[model samples]
Target: MTNHSHPSTTTTHSFKDLISMRQAVQSLFLAISLFMGIMFYLFVAQLESGAMPTLERPPGVEAFLPISALISLKYFLFTGVFNTVHPSALVIFLIVCTTALVVRKGFCSWVCPIGLMSDGLAKIHSWLFKRPVHLPTWVDLPLRAIKYTIAGFFVWSVFFKMPLAAVEQFIQSPYNTFADIKMLDFFTNISTTSLCVISVLIILSIIVKNFWCRYLCPYGALLGVISFFSLGKIKRDKNNCIKCGKCETMCPGRISIMENETINSLECSACLRCVDVCPAPNAIGFSLVSGKVPMDQRKIALVIIAAFLTGITTAKATGHWQNGTRIQAYQEHVLQDRMSSQPPMKIPANTDPEKMKRMIERMRQKKN
Candidate 1:
């Protein structure tokens, strides 16, 4: 590979500017998520108190229900119909998956609230340690596989083990209908076991950069697997590289970008830290195609935003964004004092079996 010896040139903007832009994007999504959480809590509180909810339920909160979304996705594929219980869950899921296919786990870096929290913890890790700790390959490799194994188990259970009828049945079950409320309670009324697990993960993250994201988030593993087929990637110009190793040092995923002309590693989160830190001009950047011109951080930000907005907008226009489940369903489910236990895999109380049957028949007719 050819090498350059010239001094690093100044670009239009500094790496800090790029990082600030990413932070801005992350902050926006985190704010939205928090707002949704607050709104949903109020809505549920009203329902539990035997009062009509004045605050409309925020459908965006459904984004947290990834397992329900996966099952909904399979149900849609098998029956050619969207599950109305948590339609936005599947929509957000698709949007995230699309980002992975186009931008290589950009959702993890740009959109996820957990990612924002992880980034914050990573900064703390940097402050605590003079040099970041990296586990040995033997330990790291197995730890990384933990996420894939978790993802695999879910995919296998939902897509392989569950038959089409069972998928439909589960979608209509009380568990799926009230999953969002259960998720809220999981945090609001945090259990001892859950608290311990979260505390341990937080402590580990403070010591190791991106500890949970890199080794535990099955959702991230799913995105990483899909990103292998993404058209966009971080490309390294071997000719202009100075072999300074700054890129690898700054990589959150611990990917060795200096060793590869193109970073095809599943761990690459498209965070652009490497690109921002590169001293050599045009040495490393995000590119749509291999050996092509690199895209600016601003443009990548716009693309991620646009992809999300486009997917949500399309789903809304097609009447697939908001769920069909009535607010009364939530109120009734909550008022029955049923929030304390896991919902049974049966038709929810206060739901009309005839109405559900008609709805399923309508879906089949539409398919035919």
Candidate 2:
């Protein structure tokens, strides 16, 4: 006689479990938001004041998004580091890109401040509209290309031009003075056209979930392309699926999880919404092998270990995780000395080119 076992008993996870999982991931997202805000503030402060007290980058910055890969690319091609090599930029970019490999754009969902704001806006849109809205495919696809175009422009700017004098000026400019801060006063004083573009993007993000990431964020586009080879992925066991469709609804990307069973590597963010919502016991999970590992408790420990190693290795390589406070204090002192020596100079009412040149020379001397 064959004994029949009920599936419900095998997988008894409840809504509370799903909520707990969401909270865990969302808290991580919050931490990332806080970190980005700090970075943005630093960028603004350095640019606005034209001086900054030197502060070492936090270890987490080495592997953060937009920084590492861009820096690595710059360093590799020129045999010199550019904006990509700055400690904060390098760490953030690395973390985003590497995490993308493990969890398919997890950085966007779990770390990006802009993404968090977009997510919040999406909720507001839903509440106000009282319905979920989707853009038509024709319009959506074309708009998504914008991000790629932006990425291309940035890459081209760095690689295509070899203007030695201009590059020298930029390299020696406030960028280096401020420890390679990307935010500049000019950015804060952006033209109307730029403001319009940013406004449109934010508006679009509210209208559509992940609108910027899906189509227009050059950084996300770059990372998505890199994520093609990420090891960990969301895998679905087709035989075990009961067509619940919960995963699909829960997916912020709006991917059809029920039909495909396999999450798209380029689109999935490893938010674990699908995993927690899955009713099938051990049916959906992340693994190096497709659908092979369930990411059980033991593997979760391994994942933490891997993340830690990734962080530490990155910090050590970039001089961000250095030991002792005395060295750090010295670095801070040097930065302060540099800043105090070059307070923002008011331009004199000059009537001649010679006078302007003299002023420029004085400024250059101060910078040096």
C-alpha TM-scores of all predictions? 0.88, 0.66
Off by over 4 Å in 2: 1-29, 32-72, 77-85, 152-199, 280-283, 296-309, 312-314, 317-368
For all candidates in order, the CA lDDT equals: 0.85, 0.58
lDDT of 1 by residue, 1-368 (tens): 22221112234668788779888999999999999999999989998887778888898999999999999999888889987899999999998898888789988888888899998998898889998988889999999999999999999999999899888888889998999998998989999999999999999999888999999999999999999999788777778889999988988898988888778999988888888788888677777755343466677788889987998899889999888888888877886655456576687799998999999899879845
Model 1 scores a C-alpha lDDT of 0.85
**Model 2 C-alpha lDDT per residue in residues 1-368, reported as the tens digit of each score:** 01011112133556566445444555665686468557755644553454543544443433333433453455545655434224444444555566667656666665566666776787877886766777888987688778878987877776675454554454444434343233333354577988898889778777777677777778877767777787666666677778888877777777777666456656676666677677776556665556443443234434544664677586668664432223333345446655775868676566687888898899889976
CA displacement after TM-score superposition, residue 236 of candidate 2 (Å):
2.6
* Backbone N/Cα/C clashes per model: 0, 18
What lDDT score is found at residue 333 in candidate 1? 83
Which pairs clash in the backbone of model 1? none
Model 1, runs deviating above 4 Å: 1-10, 338-368
